[model samples]
Target: MDNFYLLLYLSVAMFIGSFVAGLVPLAFNMSEGRTRLLSTFGAGLLVGTALSVIVPEGVEALYIVHTEKYLPGAVQNKDRNQIISNSLIQPVASNLAAKINYPTYFGNSVVGKGVVEQMQQSPVMDKKETDEYRHSEASVNFNAINQSIGYSLVFGFLFMFLIDQISKYLSSKDGDRTHLKLTATVGLVVHAAADGVAFGSASATNRAGVQFIVFLAIMLHKAPAAFGLVSFLLVEGIERFRIRRHLIIFSVAAPVAAMVTYYLIVVVENDKSSTDSATGTLMLFSAGTFLYVATVHILPELLGSNVKDYQLVNSATEGSSRGYSESRASLKLIELISVIVGAISPIF
Candidate 1:
């Protein structure tokens, strides 16, 4: 299937999933406990996706880029003089060249008849020259690329952290905090856009297994995120119509971003190395964001004041000790199982 068609399918699925997830809370009037549970499950899935899928894929992509960019050149130069000598001595050198799988430099075959003729006229490279070439190859640093990716991951995490902090600060200020809600909404919209970028970059890989894993991971969290956003707005006492409008806008952001990013990757970037770099960086960045969302944001909310209050009251009121213990243990067990299920679900 065409990559664009697959992207379109994912975008449509994301839109529908988010819209439905958001509507479900309003339609069913789901309890706070259930909402928290769902959020926890989603958080677990995000964590699992980050560790099990995105990070590994990002590292693999970068290594592939490294090999493509550097290894071919190294291999081509390894026995250049030897190949050149053989071509000069042998009449049927081109046939020998066809048998030997030598690397091509700048798309020029090293042992072609034309190349051999050129080599016959030129002086053979000296030991000093060969040593110089090897030295130059050794001096070429790929560690910087690895460091850049690492920094990009950290930047992604910090970027989201800053947005969250800024929104909180704005909301805490005097007067009406509706603007702050908008701020938070914008932040979430940007995050959704990042998710789109990830999807685009992953699609660029053209690997069915990778595409499926990424698509599933994004879908797993997309709806729950939308549901949580709507629930937040509801708690903020925003009007129904306004919330609906916001939800519509939110649902569109990811798909639109995905389409735009995918176009840029396929058309503008148009090179394997660049595509790999972009895709790997995006994946790592997305992983960092997912880690923050899962651990710092969602988990805390899942185990928030309600749980603490229940524990405190149960401890103070000892008359129903057995029942309280049983209920608490059951809830904890359920939460643990839900998280475990979420974490491993991506393997299928």
Candidate 2:
């Protein structure tokens, strides 16, 4: 409940910050290079959050879910054969096999490669192979869970990829690009809602810092998107009133989505273990989207600009070439360092 309140406060701050960013275009000029630099930093932050915080924590949460399910009152049940069989026993069998050269422990066995090969040639090899086929139930369960996580990650990535393709197709059409701008604005709003979902999922965890880190990354990216959206609209000769209307809608979208998502997760998950499992799945899914946005969308934009700068340097007269190249190198260095700093910030 307290986490929800914190989310509320963050949402309000997000709205205000986005609104202010939207208004920036009306007040002053913003340079292209500066915007890209800021975006580069935000992209790096996303990369770090997805890999360092979200993925690891998510895997941990899922492992806990399995532990709670399979090993309830593990200490009390340690001596019970049925209970021990349901728990993690593959590692134990393997260890015993390594130490004792044992072939079977109640149909659970681990054998050396040479032994397996020799058994393969014997008349009873078929029986041994059948026995080997059966593995610890807990191992199978963990394997299935890991596979589900991988699928979720891929699904999230592909979902974002489709969105990006649709957005690109819309913006690529020739002339009367008002619709292009509108499409882009919708995409940003959708991205914001996804950010809200990430925050909501993280908040379901016991770690407050995880939720806060996700929120920080969302804000870092959201501010630039808001500002860039308005700036683009103004350049397209959009009316101030219409632009404000769009900005308001964009600002409100995230907080609303966040509140609704958090409420739904809390209400639907009746138990701690279930809630943690759901949170883990969502976090991994969010990490995939974050990877898409950071690596596929934002970071690659630098390539085009870097090429343009290279051409400009090549075309410059000999007299100014050295100075221009030095300036460009310095700028590149700064952007690289900014990204590094942003990537490391969320970890601490």
Candidate 3:
């Protein structure tokens, strides 16, 4: 069931990750003023999902492991200091840490108790020791790990920025106003690849539950995206036959990513070296991708004025709505519903 849910969720995400704004017949055929609003709404949905789902998880993981490395701390409560008597310094350090940054984490809540224990063990437990004594205490640093995360943040921003520009160029090709369509296809491919890395990394981390959640969220959004894209493709001169083919392809993206992720998930799940802390790194990478897509690519497209489209098309058709014709509204509604279904379907 977990695998099934995982597959379903991944597929849904890949579907939404490649949305088609041109599809919703209402916006496509409506007065251009309306389309701009709806597009922004779509962008909002993506942005909301990223913040609501991905970022918190990332931050939670980041805080935990980063604190362990950055803050002088020990597991609050229970005997975190091993019984080894080698100079007693290590245990003393652990005990000191328990009293300071995370008194609760290391189990030493009594202030003087912790200080005296540390001093007696310190061979130099002096009378001068105060509550402020631990303030001077230092622990092993993880400067290198912090530095590596800094590098990742830079790389993620650059990678997504480059991709966004390329997508913009591809979306603007004259012969293919289908530029959005084409670029979207590429975006979907990239989205799938990112998901593969995410779930794969999760499997390695042994927290497959989180990976499943992401998959579910992705799938929940894609159905609408596919139908919406198809609507856009029609404006790009796509024939019905071609549109159907594209929908089929979009629908399958998650399933494929899931398969790729599965092998990796299994391998990492069994590896002893891999830890939950690694999920923090993966989450940051995904969050970076999400931020890039939501801000650089999706939001601009949504917010940029496309109202001129309605003015131009309305003029060309002499008041006839390009897509929202009486004959077409039903069809478009179906597409919109399809999108909604794709968006929310994964929860079931």
lDDT of 1 by residue, 179-259 (tens): 656765676677677777777777776766766776776666667667767777777799988888888887888888878
Best by lDDT: 2
What tens digits encode model 2's per-residue C-alpha lDDT throughout 225-283? Answer: 78877876787788999999988988888888877777777767688888888888888
What is the per-residue lDDT of model 3 for residues 1-348, given as tens digits with 9 covering 90 to 100?
Answer: 465455555555555554332234423444443443343344444454445555556555555655543333332242324322323565566565556654444455576556655644543323344223334432223544565455654565566666655654555545554455666656555654664555454433334556655554444334344444555556677777777666566555555655565554454455422343555566556656655654554333333324343221111112111222223212134334433443343233
Best-first order by lDDT: 2, 1, 3
State TM-scores per candidate: 0.75, 0.74, 0.53
Clashing residue pairs in candidate 1 are none
Greater lDDT among 2 and 3 belongs to 2
Ranking by TM-score: 1, 2, 3
Q: Which stretches of candidate 3 lie over 4 Å from their true place?
A: 1-42, 48-53, 59-141, 169-184, 195-224, 272-277, 306-348
Measured by TM-score, the strongest candidate is 1
Looking at model 1, which ten-residue stretch has the lowest summed lDDT?
A: 312-321
Question: Against the hidden true structure, what lDDT does model 3 obtain?
Answer: 0.47
Query: What TM-score does prediction 3 earn?
Result: 0.53
